[model samples]
Target: MTLAKGPLFLLVLTALALTSCQSDDKPPQPRFTSDASGSQVGKASQREGQYFIEFRSRYALTYGHTYAVFGRLNKAGGMINPQVAGLAPASADAAPYVLGHFIPVPATTGATDGDLEEAYRSASWRILLTEAEYNKTVAFIRQLQAKSKLWQATVDNCNNFVGEIAGSMGYKTPSIWLRPQEFITKLREMNT
Candidate 1:
């Protein structure tokens, strides 16, 4: 008995079609670091030796007023004093009623490393990220600077800025109503 050529061709074509439609069943291969240790070193640990964000706040002369500063630790280390950013009154008349839309400013202006010591009393929270994650976080911060109004004192102020940056680094946002000191405590609690 001879099999017909048409039937044989149809069977082969059907087999090929079914094979093409089938899903791949192989498990995904695992990714590993170049070290061969099977352990991954985080980005913060890799580049900076460490990485951190600090919040510094002090009570102003006005009873209800508090001035807060936020900064990232320099890759050189905290001993070098991180570059801090904050909001200050636009003018002397702007004081006391500091709750206006002020622009974001570098709190420490033209100050030497020696000066930063006396200028800020701060508490910091540290984090670790992969190199890719660090780059992504930086890009997010740059975008924020470009688009966000960065109005100080009024409603969206320094605390909001820091909180947003921290959140990008996988941190939870503290209560908007919390004072700087209280916010620091909350950050520590969440990070720890």
Candidate 2:
């Protein structure tokens, strides 16, 4: 049968529009995954820029404590001493840097001052760092390898190695979910 021009033209136009719209076969999914890989924690030390502290043990996503730690580091100028203000607050941000982030060495924590070396050696491995986190930590040690010259500026290993370096430089607090690109902004700021 012969078709009318107006209806036929409308049908063809509609079909073309539909085909083009359907090209994007699947609607975009959230791409959510429980895995931490590909996330910021996975790319630790990809650049020699700022460092970041992962939760000593990956905390539940719902937990606010991890963010508290991040905030403490950011606010404390990168060194949250465990003896800060009577360990004032119970939350990670308020307490002296103990628990997950650091070992409560009497020296580091300002409890006793006999031999810090022994304390560090004993406490270093006590924190629950992952293989990747541990590796970055080791690299941090090598970076801060004790200097002989007392006059030379001390390499801030506490800042660099413990992942507080980023906080020290200043970008934003609680950047636990910060991407590499985001971390770089702090690096640039510190360098400049």
Candidate 3:
């Protein structure tokens, strides 16, 4: 059957997409335990203080969120001292999510509530970092966070945020408008 197109259709489609991403009724874990690669403590870096960055896209269907995760690595190449960040509207209310569809809204960077929740990750790309690279990347993230004041869903949205971070890390990013998962998957494909 052919599909209908209009405001109501869009609303219903969005509702279905969002609803499909709801958790499987299982409660989230107490704390984030692993990076997107799956190993947290097992893949320590070649040296102490070495670091890693992983760009991730979490579920919400086409509206899924994208963010970056970084951390120190122990001598064994496993991740440690993990940190996360992303660009998003300052509020978690439906208003921002919806309003962002039209205009820019006050935004914040640094980890939001779901950044550490491993269960939401639908796509990710990771890279090991040297001490120098780690320091620079972290500094860049801070600067980006400080300067980024607004988030517009169709403009400088989450994928743009993650893509900016990825670009700083020297990875070629896919188009920012792609769904979070597709953007992330393309990121890995282009880089690796």
Task: List, in order, the clash count of every candidate structure.
Answer: 1, 1, 6
Q: Write the per-residue lDDT of candidate 2 for residues 76-192, one digit (tens) a residue.
A: 223233211011112334233222222222112111221122221111111223456545644443343332111100121122222342233232333222222222233333323
TM-score of 3: 0.73
Model 3 clash count equals 6
Worst 10 residues of 3 by lDDT: 25-34
Model 1 lDDT tens row, 90-161: 344644334342334323211122213432333333444445654576566666665554344434554565
Reference-based TM-score, model 2 = 0.19
Candidates sorted by lDDT, descending order? 3, 1, 2
- Which stretches of model 2 miss by more than 4 angstroms? 1-128, 151-192
Clashing residue pairs, candidate 2? Answer: 82-97
Best model number under lDDT: 3
lDDT of each: 0.42, 0.25, 0.70
Superior candidate under lDDT, 1 versus 2: 1
lDDT at 149, model 3: 94
